[model samples]
Target chain A: MTTADARESTPSSKAPRTERGRKTLRKLLDAAAIEFGEKGFHEASITGITRRAGTALGSFYTYFDSKDEIFRALVDDLSGKVREAARDALQSELPALETERAALAGFLSFAREHKEIYRIIDECEFVDPQSFRHHYETTARRIHERLEEGMNRGELREGLGEAHAWAIMGMNVFLGLRYAVWSEEAAPEEVAELANSILRDGIAPRSSNKG
Target chain B: MTTADARESTPSSKAPRTERGRKTLRKLLDAAAIEFGEKGFHEASITGITRRAGTALGSFYTYFDSKDEIFRALVDDLSGKVREAARDALQSELPALETERAALAGFLSFAREHKEIYRIIDECEFVDPQSFRHHYETTARRIHERLEEGMNRGELREGLGEAHAWAIMGMNVFLGLRYAVWSEEAAPEEVAELANSILRDGIAPRSSNKG
Candidate 1:
């Protein structure tokens, strides 16, 4: 499915089941990401988000209780999507390296499609420490599970059980933030290549390893 | 000399010819680091910084045209200090590996003292593209230079050169942010140990590399 279609496919039975409700919800989320990402959490208001979404002020309360609730939902939803994408890539029949490449590619694709959402999530760590910690640790553990699976299957270099997994995940996030999200010129593919090369070989000289 | 003493001994003239001018500049920088580090560049205000430094609002303008300029000064100054610290450690009468270890230790010490400043620099890349690019490339080149020096002196494994430098720098920064800045429970020394071990020995199974 196209990215927009994928993003729009959210659970709706909890909210109004009408078509208008779904469209309003989608618009609200889009506008909220932009507003929240740009202005930060404390500065963002539900009224501003609703106005930007072109919905009536009262309509906002139908979907969310407060601006904080909207932000919480937005982050939780995006985090879920990112985890699902990573898990799916891991399950695919790519080699270990290719799987990693695809997983990063998937993440970069997600960031590209939802740049504002990614920024909101990235800044959330600083904006809301408790919530960000809960989300970050959970995501780290999930990524670690994937790495452990690769190690158990002898698909990746052995002895790199958990720490290495954390390192790789953290390193990728750092790179994505600096090069892909913040950078204007560098393409995702180039960043991927650089990261992949560093991951596989490390900074040590090949000859030094033999010595 | 103690860290404080060393900072004091560095002639105030090192920054500005006038002692009063230098002190004012230092207050602005100190205030900027705290405000920017805590609230980020966009969120930090000149008024807040001046208040924190106990300087008149007009005096703030006399030193800095805008908050961005203050931020730029802080970043440039921090970057220079980090580089100079690294260089000083490397030049000491230590072996290659020892030199590297010392440099890492110096970095950890700096991180401990200026945790907020480190966060500001890391987040600054998201604030302005040109500023980030200039700092990132200069830092990268400095790292490459250190690695080259170590390799030539037979301190590091051969053939990696600039690539190795980049990976080491990337890994260290990622680890520092994750273990040090993100969570205070992690001591710099402990993170340094884990990282140093990983650097000395690859994550691959020990048996596989028994050449």
Candidate 2:
């Protein structure tokens, strides 16, 4: 979770200089996520974030000028992590549909581990509308790119575009909310496969086969 | 919009008895939608709602005791309206897949007219967690019931269960947010068709000569 990439993604004007500085920044972002996620923007305070990070109050000011700056940076950080989770799942060259399944599975696992992601991202709609919109728009764009790749490979149907990507993203997001964050009623793979089947063949009944 | 059903759906203890009372209550809820939608729950005030409603302060207290009470009532009111929109579109009998398409089209149009629905419903997650959960769970349950009917009628594939319903619900919600609420870039029918295409044949390439 603590990576140099996380540090680089920080939007603070004063970028960390050394390795220790990067770690401190990472700690602050991680702590900010929890603080904002739990207490929300109105109630969350700078001291609360530093207390959670186990860093001195000065450490917070060194990287972020104010709470709003840190919150914005934390959103960017989480957005990057969401992309990374999908990227990590897409490392292997799988079929178009399997790529989607793997990406959803990665997302479900990530959501289960970091349940606060939903809260923080959701709060962005109120606290920082731009970041909130940017997160989904960016995510949908990434999905649209994958859809194009699938179409070129002749695996997916033609005419799939931005709308289709948004549909897929929506399905994955709600599935994660119900199965991963709310409760572990179904395995991540099972849920992922169920969604994948819909994309593969839909729910239309076969002429000769009966369930 | 002012109907007996609307009044019946109100959770407040003081239900409006006369037509005038009902109209006033409806005004308050409509005004509350705008207020909460723009300012959010925390920042939204009772006076703001009353002022927009063109009702006196005493009228607000007559129907709703506090800002929290009005907010809860507004969520219920919006949820009911959503159901009514779908129900209105479903007057005629159609195939299961077609039924879904009609319902989504209905939702898209409704969302276009009442853009504040998303903001109010999303804020419920923070202000009133139970109501937020209820809104989605209830919507998903309704979708699941429809899938069951489709399965029973041999119109849809068997093994389509709660997960499939959730998938469909998620698709419609996000489609509405992107196409309807954010901007009317695409026609409602077009957005609905893009989603229906997924439910009907999915994104997979079709084989030769398959209906």
Model 1, A1-211: lDDT tens digits are 1133223223343465789887887788778888887787778888889889999988887887777767866776677777766666667687666667678767766676666765677566666655566666666677677667767777556655444565666656655655556653556666666566555544455566566
Model 1 chain B: worst 10 consecutive residues (lDDT sum): B1-10
The whole-model lDDT of each prediction reads 0.65, 0.88
Query: Which candidate tops DockQ?
Result: 2
C-alpha positional error of residue B131 in candidate 2 after TM-score superposition, expressed in Å: 0.4
Candidate 1 chain A: worst-modelled 10 consecutive residues by lDDT: A1-10
RMSD of every candidate to native, in Å, equals 5.9, 2.8
Shift in Å, residue A58, candidate 1 = 3.9
TM-score of each prediction = 0.74, 0.94
